[model samples]
Target: MLRVKVAKEIREKEQLGDELKTLRSKVKELEKSLSGLKDEHARLAENEEKFRTLIENSTDLKYRCDLKGRISYLSKAWEDALGYKSTEMIGSKFSDFQSPESIKFDADEFLKELIDKKISSYEAAYISKSGNIIHLRFNVMLYRSHTGSERGIMGTAYDITGLKCIEDQLKQSQKMEAVGRLAGGIAHDFNNLLTAIIGYSEMLMMNNLLPENAFQSADEINKAAHRAAALTQQLLAYSRKQVSRPRAFNLNKLVNNLDMLLRRVIGENIEFFTVLEIDVGLVIADPGQIEHVIMNLAANARDSMPNGGALTFETRNVNLDEEDCEKYPEVTPGPYVRLTVKDTGHGMDKETARHIMDPIFSIMDPIFSIKEGGRRTGLGLATAYGIVKQNNGQLRVTSEVHQGTAIEIYLPRAEEKIEKKETPQRKLETEGGNETVLVVEDESAVRIMVGTLLKGFGYSVIEAKDGNEALEFCRQNKEMMIHLLITDIIMPDVSGFDLVKRVIKTHPGTKVLYISGYSEEEISNKGTLGKKVPFLKKPFTPTVLARKVRGVLDRD
Candidate 1:
């Protein structure tokens, strides 16, 4: 019986040992799992830290909002962009910082984009702390819970202020091109008509057969036609299509010349002051057009202060650099002459000032004056804009409501020395020779008027209605000793340039005289030697025509 009891104790001890080994194995496995859990927790903590660092340092404006569009969290970029601390921005609605136009667009259009798309992007204008405009491009996505239920919205924004400025400038450029096309076409046609009217009126006034009253009527007609011609020139100037007679001239000299006229223009009630800087740099531009620019600005300044205020004109030399060019991409970096005109009168708003210089806006809104009871024409600013641009210059305006207005025009400095005005030339005979001349003009009235003038000047004249007729006459009368070929620069069938080339082959001895109503620039586009050859501009009086004919015939 003792032996059997010992065997049972041994078996029970073995079973107990087996159970202890199993518990030890399970404890070892649990310790390994705990070590793994610690490592995983450390890795996850490191990842979260990296994400936080990235979000904090990002230049993109990152933000989160609740369903009601309330501010939830914002990154550091918001402060740099808007001059506002994150604390001040927290819990505020995004619309609070937006411009009125942006807010209206978000409510009316952006919400629809969000509803139709999981991610929506939009360009918005936000108001800065200083009331300046900041343009931003927002790329937004719907923030959702793990279960796919919508919780809020989150987005990133990029600064697009500079890009927006370039876009606005491009739009302004396109509008100016359109305006140029429209205005240039009208002016070109009107110039042709004016040439005939003025030429005929001058001839009538010179006629010895008319009564004194008839002479008065002819004088009046000539004056009216000249006025009409001036109007056409203004249209061309504003469209930058006018042929500019650019010469290096002193800006200070021009200011002195305009002093008396400006005094009368500003009236007795207004105070006018001249602050001309001696030895101001010379500028290259059409002096007449620059005068127009000054007159337009001065007139507007006078009208702005109808109740009598101070008007000041300041002239100085400025050296513009890359930094200046950066602010104004339309201008080149170089020496410039700055003409500043200031008025103590009501100013314009930002919106109005932005579009005020646009030619299209000026045309559409003729009565759009800047101040109360102002009679200034809408073309005032636009005319200045075109003239400055044509001269490779810039125009800037700075003003605030209730404050005064300041306009600064920058014209490029000329490298050439200022040339003195021409003295009277040696008088040439106003009689034509017995040489045969061909007059080519499309307009019958203008052609007839030119023919009569040449005939009276003692030249044998042959009138051709068009370029084809002119060329055909030259071909048929190949042996005819054509002493002079007077042809229009721009023609429908054949250009005056082509006619000259072909006629020279047959009549090499013929002296060529090109005439046109088109501006020098336009004529150059049509023919190669528009400005290079002996040219006579249209709207010439009988005396001028007579001198031109004799001068061309006598030239070796």
Candidate 2:
């Protein structure tokens, strides 16, 4: 019995040892699995850190909005592009930052489509903390939870505000260019017609053969034509096509001289003052046009303050460089004189200020004056803009609702001495020239008027209806010693400049005189009329025509 018990105990001990060894092996396996898990956790943590760093530094705005349109996440770019704090914006809906119009048009329409489509791209406009518009291009998709259920909207946005600004500026420039072209075309035709009316009336008055009543009637026609001519000139001025008589003059002197006139313009209800820089540099612009600009600003200031306000004119000399060029791209980098016209009156909002300098905007705007007679012609700030532009200057306006308006006019400083122009007194019985003159005109009335006036001045005269006809006349009368070739600047067949080029090749002795209703860039390129070549402007009286013909013949 004792031997049997010992054998059984040994067998049991052997089984216990096997079980313990198996348990130890299982423990080893578990320890290896735990080590693998720890490695995976460390890798995952590293990946999360990288992702967070990328999202924080990315220029593209990253946002996640829940199904209820409440924002859950916002990237750091949101704060960079817009003047808003990321923490402040994280709980808010996109509509909170959007402009009212953008909310009404963009979010309402685009968000509806996005909801239906699940994945889409769109553009949205948001107002910045500083009240500037921020345009964004969003690429969004509906994200899902682990269970594949729709979770929230996640998107990336690119700031497109700069592109939007460039687009708007391009559109405004195109619009202004079209308007300028239309105004210039109208003035060109109107000036030609006025030349005929004024010329024929003067011829009738010059005859001295008509009755006293007939002469008075002719005088009335001449006066009416002159008034009409003035209207055309205003149109030209607005289009930057007017014949400018520019002179170098101190802007401060001009402001001082117009102090009383400006005060009268603003009336007693308004206080007038000038902060003149005593050493303001000289600017080369038409003095009359500059005067008109001053009075127009005063008038506009007066109109803005129907009851009472203050009108102030400030002048200063500024030296512009690359830094200023960035701000005023239209201005050249050089010395300039700045004229600031400020009015403490009801000011314009951004919308109104944007279109304030557009031609004829005053006719549509309610803030402009309708008085000052029809002579004002509803140009308002537009006239000043054109005058400034034609004189190689820029006009900038800044205004806020109820904050008053400030208009800054920047004109380049002139280095050359101002040449005083001799204002020739009108002589009804001017001297005649015996030299031959060729008159070319597309309009029969102007042609006939010119020919008659020249013939009566005791000069040999030949006329053509167009450039082609004049070219033919030059071809036929090669050895005629044509003496002078007077032609219109623009025609359908050949231009006046081209005609002169061809005529001068054959008739080298022929002097050339160009006539046009309005000045052109081409005129400036060739040295303005009466510079390199003698030029006669249209709408001249018989005496004026006679004097011009004599001057050309006498100049040798």
Candidate 3:
């Protein structure tokens, strides 16, 4: 019995040892698992350090601030860009660098957004440590602790000062372009009215209706009307609506002849200098337009100098090679006659110089502090630009504030020697035949004036208010022989061009004369008749209208 009891005790001890060994194995497994976890943690820590280094050294400005708007930290980029040490700005309020005008409202709005939106972004200007204004696009988010409690605000800001400046310049340029187009349109119509008035006045003066005293009054009216007409022509030139009769002409002769007039116009206070190069090559341009361009430029120079200064007009021969064409895409490679107008006056700033050729730029002189009286209508330079462009020329300007301004016009030399066309003698006056003529116009005054003028010329006249009426009249007169058709370019129902086409189709032998206040190019584009058809520009004098009608009717 004693031996059996001792064996039981030994068995119990063996069982106890087995349980202890199993417990040790379990402990060893747990230790291995912990070691693996520690290794992974270390790897993660290294990756986190790399990420922090990248953020701290990134070119983009990275920053963090407390919920109360006090800056906690800023990346090295901010310090490098804005000339600020990160340590010096770390404890400062974010509003400290903001513009005072926008600070309170902007700060309040931003703080509210941070609390409500979790993320907010904006573009704003900030004052740097160097007192320079820097534009920045800021993207910020509210940071939260692991427990979901708000900690601080963090953001990245990108410098955008250069981009902002370019955007502003673009906006100004667009505005100037729009205003130039508007001014050009208005000037075109105004020119037509002035043309009619001046032409009629000249015809009336030839009538010999009054004594010398009355003649002076008529002369004054004529002078004033002519002056106004000249102004309107300038406007038309600016609008690119002016009819340019380009011919090869000697630039030297033109400038020399106009020198005296230019000097007189600029007045004695301002000194005028002409650097006319001897024997400059002939240029293909309208002489009247070139004259107007010179006059307008001289006037502008005069105004620039309230306290008299030197104005120089220089002419030279230049060969525009491939390099010049590359630099100025608008110019072609050829021999060119360069006309430069320089002025020693209060020079224009970059902004003003950029818009000098804009029709409405002069209007803003007061606001921009470029000029005081603002008496000079900015149309002068715009007209010069348009005329130069129409003549296949290039205009370039250089100006420095307080130094001076220089404008250069490069006109291509005439390629071919233009033959002079002799002017035909005026036709002998003749009583009109008994043939009927159709006159179509939209404006009643213009229509009546035309009818009266046609009657004075002794042609039997039939008038229509519009194209539809004109068409009806032609249909009704299918049997009657209509000698000539005088019609306005623009009308309701059917345009003059369409009516002409329809009439020509029905009455193949019918003759048509187109009239318009618009440029001849504009009238021809109506598809009326081919370029072979003649166009009479409005507003025509009674005699001029009579002559045109008679000429068309008598054409072979």
- Computed on alpha carbons, the lDDT of every model, listed in order, comes to 0.83, 0.81, 0.76
Number of the candidate with higher lDDT, 1 or 3: 1
Give the lDDT of residue 147 in candidate 2: 100
Candidate 3 C-alpha lDDT tens digits along 1-556:
9999999999999999998899899889889989988998998999899988998879999989887778988888988777789888888876677765544435566778778884478776778888767888889898889999988889899998777755765575466456646755665566456545655555456567567777677668768866676666666677666778888888878888998999897789999888888868789888888888888888778877878999998999999998677646557798999999999978888657777765565445453324356554446576788788778898877898878889999998987665344478787464455568888878666676677656756778999999888888778767777788888776767998888888776567878888877776555566644566878776555566677777777889
Off by over 4 Å in 3: 1-105, 125-135, 142-192, 211-214, 237-262, 271-294, 312-342, 348-361, 364-436, 520-530, 540-555
lDDT for each residue of candidate 1 in 1-556, tens digit (9 for 90 to 100) = 8999999999999999998999899899988999899999999999999987899899989999877777899999899999899999989887888998884444435544676794388777999998889999988878789999878879898999988877887788778878877877888788778878888888888789989999999999999988887777777887888878777898988988999999998899999998998878888888999999998888888877878999999999999999778757888898999999999988778887888888766767744544456454646787788888888888898887778789999998888775557567888766767889999988788899989878876789999998888878888987899988888888887888888899899889899888887777777787687344788776666777778878888887
C-alpha lDDT (0 to 100) for residue 9 of candidate 1: 99
Off by over 4 Å in 1: 1-59, 83-89, 103-119, 146-149, 366-378, 416-429
Tell me the lDDT of candidate 2: 0.81
Each prediction's TM-score versus the true structure: 0.85, 0.80, 0.66
Q: How well does candidate 2 score on lDDT at residue 114?
A: 70
Candidate 2 local lDDT, 1-556, one digit each (tens) = 8999999999999999999899999988889888888998998999999999999999889999887667999998888788899788888888788877774334445556776895487787999988888899888888888999878889899998877765766666567668877888888888789889999999899886799999999999999999887777666777787778888888888899988878877899999988999767789888898888888778888777777989889999888898776555567799999999998888988878877876657666555636434334357787778878889888889998887899999988989655455589565448877788889889888999989888887889999998788888878878888898888888777878888889899789888778887665536654344465777776666777777767767665
Of the pair 1 and 2, which is ahead by TM-score?
1
Cα deviation at 552, candidate 3, in Å, is 3.8
Clashing pairs in 3: none
Q: Which candidate is the best by TM-score?
A: 1
**Sorted on TM-score, highest at the top, how do the candidates line up?**
1, 2, 3
